[model samples]
Target: MRRGMRPLLALAVTLGASTVAHAHSVHAGLSADGRLVVSAAPAAGLTRFDPHARSPPHRLPSAGGTESTVSVLIDHAAMESGLAPSLLRAVVQQESAFNPAAVSRAGAAGLMQLMPGTARRFGVHDRFDPAQNLRGGAAYLAWLLRHFNHDTDLALAAYNAGEGSVHRHGNQIPPFAETQAYVRSVRRYEAQWIRKLRAE
Candidate 1:
């Protein structure tokens, strides 16, 4: 078996046993196995796999403990877009830890940790601008969702590593420990979000 198949196989094996719960008021459901399983409700929006799953879920520190400008920006954007404040918070936290002024060794910057080229493409003049940075990051995520056909895991893997890396590996999660862990972390959070949505 190819090494890339390991994670998928593992996921399949674990799918039937996992259970998630969360506290929130939303309309959605998650399967016992952890795949995004939604109930038949009109209010529940579309659910599908994304092809260009590239970004990973960022882990942020707790609020009121060590707040940062990037965290505030992400929270504001999530609120404005109605895309789950916690999800955005988690993404940014994992990406840059709410560092509005963070610059990755690879040149990713700002709250969402936008790459220099990505920032320019998104028309963001200043990655430090909280609003602009969040908007660009969110926009990039939306693009990735479309690219990956809504497969959250794939999209996240691509985000952490790069779309090229995912493609080079035959559309599988790349062989990077950080990227792999990032996907799992985001999926766990997403599961929680879905659970909360369903409980409501």
Candidate 2:
């Protein structure tokens, strides 16, 4: 408010220790090799935002980094399993937001969120290994697609909530809210990935 106090206030703002600043930066997106990458300085702080943007902005960065290595792996795995890479990316996005080490409270681990049993079932010895994880996830997704007669929605639901849930629901999408939301989110992300591919 006064001339003498201005320098301290300016320093506080510059150091991001003021009421309106953050001290760290968040870096996320894809690697040059097409592998998704995300890291935040442990000190990174959150900021308030405008809730009424015309288009809801991304809470976190997305795939523009285009990790080529990940892309290559997904392409090979998806093709071998007869699934689309774009769709696979969508699933990965939903499962872990591309965080290969991400683990859920339910004990699902890795980018595809493979539960311990599921990882073992798929012969994935290391769920944190992106290649192995994607391979297992892609294989399971292909199986689910086939089991559900190629119904994308049903297959996605099965991935999110388990095939048993889909079966209990008469092979339709399970009626659980989380499952439904997961399916929708995957589809939305899948479409975006598809568009990105086309643009490229």
Candidate 3:
């Protein structure tokens, strides 16, 4: 584990996947019902094809309050990786707003916007798989947080602009506007989720 090491490359992959749910038009959640449910981005989240392998039931976590079928999966993934569920939710919000089928213009895929190389490094063969995507993203985030001494800001900055940029700027958040905004946005989401958890 390289602490505070600069990341020169985006965790990227070149494989093409469905930008939105394309297998079938239904809620492909972690349930035995096999009912496809899109929470926020319906058109962008619903699947046209059936995603087999029923998702694990939504288990309520200690902090995130009552979890939805969709949310429970993310919360569990974060918790399994020794992370705060709220923080990971914030990242998912920023990355793809929990859209497992999302694909960024930069080729970042799945819910976490994982780049091709990064996806492979994280063992995410199917970026569109929500479970796999969330697991991989949480793993990467945990690694980054450790590398940055638990400095959420620095870790997020590195996550957005690559750790290399942080190192180049003397182990601080880079000056890139996109990276700066991204860090701020993620933190804001983090705070929001934290508050939500407390209220719950």
The numbered model that scores best in lDDT is 2
As a TM-score, model 2 comes out at 0.67
TM-score, per-candidate, Cα-based: 0.58, 0.67, 0.70
Question: Given candidate 3, what's the lDDT at residue 132?
Answer: 82
Models ranked on TM-score: 3, 2, 1
**Residue 145, model 3, lDDT:** 91
Best of the two (2, 3) by TM-score:
3
Candidate 1 structure quality by residue, lDDT tens digits, 81-160: 55666566667767766545456667677667888888888778766555688888877776676688877678788878
Model 2, runs deviating above 4 Å: 1-69
lDDT of 3 at 113: 80
Better of 1 and 2 by lDDT: 2
The local distance difference test score of each candidate is: 0.57, 0.66, 0.64
Task: Please write out the lDDT profile of model 3 over residues 1-200, one tens digit for every residue.
Answer: 12101110101110122423344433222223433233323344232222322332222122222123247567668888888988898888888655455666677876678888888998988876767888898899898999999998998998888888899999998988899999999989999999987877
Which of the predicted structures, 2 or 3, would earn the higher lDDT when compared with the native?
Answer: 2
List model 2 lDDT by residue over 54-126, tens digit each: 2211222322222342566667778889998899989987787665546776777766888878888888976
Deviating ranges (above 4 Å) for candidate 3: 1-67
lDDT ranking from best candidate downward: 2, 3, 1
The residue-level lDDT of candidate 1 at 32 comes to: 51
Predicted structure 1: lDDT: 0.57
Q: Kindly report the root-mean-square deviation of model 3 from the true structure over all alpha carbons.
A: 11.4
